[model samples]
Target: MSHTEQAMPRRAGQQGLWVLVAVAVSLALLAGCGDDGPTDLQPDAGTEPEVCGPSDVWCKDQTIDRLDLLTTVSTGEVREEGTTSGEFLTFVDSRAGGLSPTMSYSYLRFTPQGLTPVQIHDQESLGSTDWDLAVRRYTLRVNSGTSGPSCVSVANTPEGTTFASVTAVNAAMEFKTEAWFDTACTLIPDDSGLNGPLTQLGGFWAYTSCVQMTGRVFVIRLADGRHVKLEVTSYYEPSAQQVCNQTGSVPQPSGSGAIRIKWAFLP
Candidate 1:
């Protein structure tokens, strides 16, 4: 979905919901190293709801017995997959990553009366959350008005005066617990380009990838007082000396260059 089209339905009282931004850059894709100028894969508009694949969206290892927590992947992967309405799809800043919750954990559901936008650092624990969804509980360090403690949260729950809506702001905190790995990504050259130096860089950069971005990451205060951050966030910085080896005497011992997303922006 487009950025501007994203809507908020949470009631106020809560301010500064942690929102991660994922911005990937592809010089090859933008440079037209292939046949098509842009990857013409028609992004399924909200028009025809398609099937929700498990990977499309789901609570990993979550028990379906609880009922409405989540539906089948084919049930609501995207807006089109589910019913005709747009409520089934909760599209956050995915330029972010996946946040899947397991079925064996205890979670709290809150319905607010008003929802407003505010930025905060630390707040009260809305409730004990389990990203892994195991028996372990993680403290929820909310973005309070003043960057408060590791736990606690503030909310604008249906006072009636303000236009309010409630949302599971911490769903990702309840799931998507994988830490960012600087070594899990790589780069590939544009071989489709018959030009001079274009073919030489093909796949030559995969082993030379040095960008590690844990975009939209946060130091969340868990139920136990421990702190955690989400993956594919801005805090992720890959080691520079971990990519391609042009020679036995490479200057930095590895590549330390961050990948460029033609239209990248700092979070």
Candidate 2:
């Protein structure tokens, strides 16, 4: 029989098998060579706490804690005024241990959470006392309604005045105008009598001459660009003991009045 016409029965089933294998290899190579580009990933949302904004309802509704700054000056001491620290918050007795009005001023470091003391420069190099060398970190303003000086009202409420900075507060004081809404902003008087809702350093006294820090909200700004809204909840100890004596003398050590404050970090 001629070779061209000869039957090759074993090769019939596997006919075109090489071509099929080549096509399968080509497909596999194409898949392997596909563009495996970088994926666009995103960060997880809501990982951080939402900061309270100025107009947020939470700002008005949040409970204000009573922070006490005690009479004694030291670091990490929890008094009625708030936490006491020579670095973050300091009540500088210009009288060198005397707590007289105008004779005493305070330097507070305005952080997001609370107040701190201004940094003290080296006294030996400058030849000035620490109190003299210390700078004013922030200013405090007294917010009373247009009716003026209601110590009994709830502080920083929707009905009450809002917070104001030191400059605006001083302007309000100078112009005798309102700091928030129609609420009048009173300049803290230098008198030791604790009269007229005057903005004294550390805390303010009520019309009754008691260190009741209700309805007193202060808008304070720091040099480092922090603004805070704070209220004096109490200027007395938990036992209803006053922080400062009406006679302008320091309270007895046992009965010493501490500064109690309720504050919020503002945007």
The top-ranked prediction according to TM-score is: 2
lDDT of candidate 1 over 96-154, digit per residue (tens): 11224322122222112111112110111111121211110111212211111112222
Tell me model 2's lDDT, rounded to 2 decimals: 0.33
Error of 1 at 218 (Å): 1.3
Task: Report the lDDT tens digits of candidate 2 across residue range 14-58.
Answer: 666877888999999879865553333433344433332112111
TM-score of each candidate? 0.15, 0.34
The runs of at least 3 residues in candidate 1 whose Cα sits more than 4 Å from the true structure, single-residue gaps closed, are 1-68, 71-214, 233-267
Show model 2 residue runs off by greater than 4 Å. 1-106, 119-204, 241-254
Provide the clash count, candidate 2: 20
Q: What is the lDDT of residue 101 in candidate 2?
A: 26
